[model samples]
Target chain A: MTLRKRIIACLDVTDGRVVKGTRFVDLVDAGDPVELAARYADEGADEITILDIGATRDARPALLDLIGRAATALDVPLSVGGGVRSIADAAAFLDAGADKVAVNSAALRDPTLVELLADRLGSQSVVVAIDAARSAPRVWRVRAVAATEETGREAVAWAREAVERGAGELLVTSIDRDGTRSGYDLELTAAIAASVRVPVVASGGAGSVDHVAEVLEAGAAAALLASTLHFDILRIGSLKRALADRGLSVRLPRPAPSAQQVAAWLG
Target chain B: MIAVVDFGSGNTRSVLRALAAVGAEACLVTSPAGIRAAERLVLPGVGAAPSAVEELMARGLWEPVRRWGADGRPLLGLCLGAQLLLDGSDEGDTPGLGLIAGRCRAFPSVADGGPRQVPHIGWNEVRTDSGAFDAYFVHGYWLDADPAAVTGWTDVDGFRFPSLVRSGSMTGTQFHPEKSGPTGRALLSAFAAGALDARVEAATWS
Candidate 1:
């Protein structure tokens, strides 16, 4: 049976804090990544991706620890990206128990890095990160890991090529719409999904349940969201029901309330 | 205590919050020692199966958790955590904990034709006896399980995939309970209530 799409929550952790913003500006602090991850987990996030954002080995170790702690405490898949440049970094994250290590700027500098990673970590362990945004002629270019470097690459082709070279999945984000809450760049997402053979996780913009509906309809295998979930504006149940109403096939968890959900349970 | 096994994946805090939200005395522990100390265990995991299993091995939680599940403690695996409950997984060639019998792997993300993507993400309906319930999914691979063993299923891309599997005391779901809204909370609450076997009212999709 074909697996239903997933709703992933992106936690941008900087110094152990969950930091998020649109276009990487007007950032706000939600809480500790661990705390925030837990909150989302309770809220029913399908998957949690922790992008360290900062590029450092120390941070890598800490992130791995976080991953280990998360793996033990969580019941969902945790994807760790950011600041990863070498096999060592990927290994570290995996050693801490990450499902996949996402590579962006590092792979762009050396397209072969994706292949190398696939060889070392296996393609399933390597996730190629594509931060896509429109450039001249409405062309899509990938923003590097930390938005530092620009690559002369096409996102749709990049997705196809990465999978061709053994990359397992594509985690593509729209830099323009990141944190915009306007919605996902379904146009770009759909375009890339068409070009890729592997699973493409549409990231960058997700403001509401409607945005999620738009992207899933646009053909994304999954949609990645940041910030939207933290505020409780867009919830998993509502989104799932919304998608179901639109005829998407998803699994609904039993809506059993915890004792604490009852005010009287506090006593 | 309903134990949340800590393997350092992501959102340990979040799962605990979920457990707390459900009014389960959720305790986060990394070692099998703590796991053995609990009445029930929630083996929540994310990231890679092999690595997660590796860490579980490292912490010496593998055997005990298996034994715990064997001894009638209700074990719930979520997402990758759920995937690891199987016999084998395609991600990283890792052998699952075998608490539940099945091979877990990623299928072709999209059907052979059209422009669909992989890692099927987002929310959809979970069909049940009462009616269809809305929930979320976020993974490339699903449980390739025997139809009888699959307690829950979802249709995607014209294919039916197992979404939840319950074998004895072991219950697992590919969806995340913490991220799911009211319905998800209800599901977890039911599990906590020890009523996972019963189907609830047909939820109106938002």
Candidate 2:
């Protein structure tokens, strides 16, 4: 069985605007989320993610309009999340042409909502988003939404339970490793890889292409990124070729990104 | 029309737009039948293990997605979507699709207190040991498994993680491209165009 690997493009949005940066401290305007997403699709992004970072401070109702434009603009899959409060909100994203809606704070508020959503949409539609922190050694806890200001919860344990309850996948982000460029927390990643039965994509702390290889080697089925690609320092075609050469079983191109396209991208 | 599962996770709109912008015929699908009939499948997600998987289940696409990945019928998982391909996650003690042989864990050195913030966000160089171009990253939990499974990698604070991976019929990433400028655009294009041939062809036929 030959599987084609996918490259996912994520856009962290705030107040209907696309933002780019390293630490989430100093961010620059990338462009309109919809326009940029469409451009990347034209360039060859396998999928797209629209993250509403602003959803934390204020519910971004404008996302509906943005979603409509973005959905109408691309032919690939698109998923949206951030401040998604209820099943109705999830439905709203789909109505706007989103393929999925990620509920974070809401899910934290009601863990059983995963089961509720699973019953309504199925097991694959409900995604539990945990933005957690390390309170102590080997102890990761849900950082917000009632589980707040405490460190008694074990993140790994919750992951297993979520699957049992009815979650199809997991997206784990290390608030510490995020935007650090120091490299991913491999030790933590390994631990998660060892425990979970589902595919795990490593996130946070990447500076070079080798990091991608490192996470994959660590057993992550996928690598989620942000900074490097924004810098125009790495190209996916080259990375694919490099992976293919390493005998890691990558999605090889009959004719990868033309030298021109790659060069243009680098520029 | 192809199905793009939506339940409240991932950068689904951008993925859809990328497809349409590139002139690929696609749709954001939510029903079991719609997903089952999709010529090709694109699974995108974000957030915690429990929640991400929870949403996938809520959408009633667990069976369909699992079947697609298992069948090797041109399936792609991006960012958290890619992570879901793993067996489990430490973020929320959640299990994933199990398409790949690995688990997701929390970041280390968080207790150490210097720069071990959760949700590793931002753009950094992605120089891979494979001698390929570098990429970017943004998240907290990382992947840990066998060294042989890596496709691409990047460095940050002296640590490294796989930016890309491929295990049989599945592939995934831990980055956001809809935000990455031109380099991201090129990569996304390659994914929709050059990087994948089987899926594109199958999608066309379907």
Candidate 3:
């Protein structure tokens, strides 16, 4: 009866296809972005995050089309990120059926964008994505521009500022562990979660059910999965059941009615 | 036609989309005249209570919407729209439409010695008398009212609140039926099919 912790499927779409890579390179085709999104939604993903890794200016139309198609198929919340630099950019995604827009590099460049987006679209629709990497001993720093540049800002501090600027949720991605299958950065996620009042979605390094459960124990309101799900290493229903068996609340799909029952009901 | 009130809120598109998916013929109505013209009305809103109320007032939809519900016409409120049907809200100390005798209150930031985030996002179950169904939710404020007013209840970190309510011809759901997949679709389809209307009529005559 409690609020279920979210299991979000991340679709790192590049050049109109879903791709997964280790630490944001050596990209390999996962599936068609829209098809994978629809499949994950059917598999009971609580939410879906579509990050257009190839979101150049010219790629906007294709990304929008993909998002529109995916949104049409999804019944759960869908969040889109990558190249969202302005209010108009966020609006475009919403118009294309995205429930929330995740902004990382743009919000770091100008935090006011978060405020603007919150003002126009409500704070609940704004998701500030923080890509963090280990910079020094026991320190994680925020990275921008698809995790290619360092902002010199501490991850926890940036998270607080993002919330203050009106980000309803934080999508904290561990660049060091993304696709590494080691596990989420527990220390980094817990730090950010403790520093902010908004919900934090822990992303990257989800290789097993325990990894996912561990991050949630560290205080992430949601766990974002990509490669494990895209490559069919894990199923959403079984993962949810495992999480539930550990006493964590999750939305389990209802059993479908039998064909005979369906016939009787239709009659 | 069913008029989906559009006050420039973010959820209008989703509401319209869901209604269309349910095969409900709906249109975005902003003016009071449009509100009056519709056979049925849907008030779908997001954001703060004050601003949402202001948007309704700005479009002259505030009074007409109140009257539409008062006339026992079929009306559906979604999320913030549902909150606005109450007398007032703790969010911004805002006044509501006074159609329902209740208030909107914020969810506790801390419950059971653990931090509970505001703006409870994602999917949760809405338990009715018949059964429980998973539905999507995203809000910090919840309706504080008599249990008799509630048709469905949901729990968030030990804080139980009304998730679905019905008063006369008007129905309100705290969860987003438009985004809640099949369960939500069934609710919307039931609403479109005059399921609530039939019950309201039965009560009125009885």
Listed in order, each prediction's TM-score against the native is 0.64, 0.54, 0.90
Among all windows of 10 consecutive residues in model 2 chain B, the one with the lowest summed lDDT is: B110-119
Clashing pairs in 3: none
| Worst ten in a row by lDDT for model 2 chain A | A258-267
At residue B75, what lDDT does model 2 achieve?
Answer: 67
Number of backbone collisions per candidate: 67, 183, 0
Task: Show the lowest summed lDDT stretch of 10 residues, model 3 chain A.
Answer: A258-267
Top-TM-score candidate index? 3
Taking the tens digit of each residue's C-alpha lDDT, what string does model 2 give over B1-206? 54667766646766666556555677888878888788767787655668877777887888788878888766667778877777888877887788877887776673544233234543445444434442334466777644565666655544676666665535576765544444544565555543542333455775
Residue A178 lDDT (model 2): 71
Identify the runs in model 2 with alpha carbons over 4 angstroms from their true place. A2-5, A21-26, A56-59, A145-151, A252-267, B1-206
How big is the positional error of residue B5 in model 3, measured in Å on the Cα after superposition? 1.7
Tell me each candidate's i-RMS in Å.
8.7, 11.9, 5.8
**On residues A116-196, what C-alpha lDDT tens digit does candidate 2 reach at each position?**
765665554556655556767877776544223443456787777766676655666666777676777676667776776
> What DockQ do you compute for every candidate structure?
0.19, 0.06, 0.32
- Off-target runs (Cα >4 Å) in candidate 3 are A255-267, B108-115, B200-206
